[model samples]
Target: MSDEHEHQHEMPATHEHQMGSSLSMAVAATLHCLTGCAIGEIAGLMIATAAGLGNGWSVVISIGLSFLFGYSLSTLPLVKVGVAPLAALSVVLAADTLSIAAMEVTDNLVMVLVPGAMNAGLVNVVFWVGMMISLTAAFLVAVPVNRWLLSRGKGHALTHEFHGMAAAESGWRRWLPSLPTGALVSVLIAFMLGGLVVSIADEAGWQHSSSAAATTRPAQDNPAALALR
Candidate 1:
């Protein structure tokens, strides 16, 4: 009877551990997705700004790149293990599309709502501040989405099986067992890239401003406009 009672007590502990593991995995998966989306979005916005594109075009580019990077990042690991390209793509799409879409929508909406954020030059502090806040909001919004999908064995849960298989085959299961570490690394890399892009954009903005000022005549210096007044 003691043994039976001990086993019963252990069962609840096992169940709780599994639940905790699932939640942690879900958070890791969501973070990974957010990192990819943030990298793509930032890169796209930087390019569009450099090219003098309008907000509409910038948003189009940002959304396109977000999906591309998000899908590619998630799919690459599967493909590396000899999964068929089509199957890998499908799995990535199934696992990450909703999460990516939700993040992008929330981020873009925040950017648009932030006064002058969409129009602010890269050198402007408002632009970077708004981007940071929007990304944070998007992360918060995506977490519950990932958790819900994970609970249903969808979203990132679909990819967990592949991760397990790959880890087992490559003997990485023992060394780097947790997915959260990998996810954190990805997020760090993305932020670093974003900072680099912002630096480049700031330098470019300064050059552009200087060149424009050097070539364009001041309004007060235009005698023809003065005569009309």
Candidate 2:
């Protein structure tokens, strides 16, 4: 066989990589979406929990804010770069709606399913622990969805073209620093983890306090101590 013929006979198994071929890219997009979702979810749940709202209202409020913040975060960058407000919003709605929906559904389900999580007040350890758990679950659920959409040149892929739009813009928007989506995502992730640590510490301290009480209780006041005797 000629070299040219051999070269032309590339295997069918070989395929070109697509936009979402990078797992890290998908992760970054998901994290970007998650930053907004977490803010809305946590805020809604915190408000609902504090106000003693029912689970239904809590889910409704959270879902509403999830879309609100998700669209706002995605839209603001475009608007700052001189895309018209309505146009920016239209693009964002198309770009982030599905991702937010997937995240919100998964997130709300976790909060609803976890025992006493909904009723747990903002100050309660259960609430913060639950917040961490819900966001983690939502993140896991959304990554795959974003990856699927990106592979087809949809989802966050739509926004990729606008990445550097701010570079050429000059005006009042210049005074408004570009919002760093990745930095914001990192902050939200750290907050969730911090809450998790606090919840764990709170739980451990309560357990230790209970154990200490049991160990040091006066014999006469302790039914268990009397029984052992």
TM-score of each: 0.71, 0.78
Instruction: Please provide, for model 2 over 107-205, each residue's C-alpha lDDT reduced to its tens digit, 9 standing for 90 to 100.
Output: 888888888888876656778777778888998999989888888888899988888764436676666555687789778878877876777787899
Off by over 4 Å in 2: 1-22, 167-169, 201-229
* Regions of candidate 1 where Cα sits further than 4 Å from its true position: 1-15, 166-229
Pairs that collide in candidate 1 are none
Pairs clashing in candidate 2? none
Query: All candidates' lDDT scores?
Result: 0.82, 0.81
Model 1's lDDT to the true fold? 0.82
**For residues 1-229, could you state the per-residue lDDT of candidate 1 as single tens digits?**
9999999999999999988987787778778888778878888898999999999999999999989978877876776665776998999888999999999999999999999989987666677778888888998899889888988999998877777554335543234323344664666667655765776688789899998887665645889877877
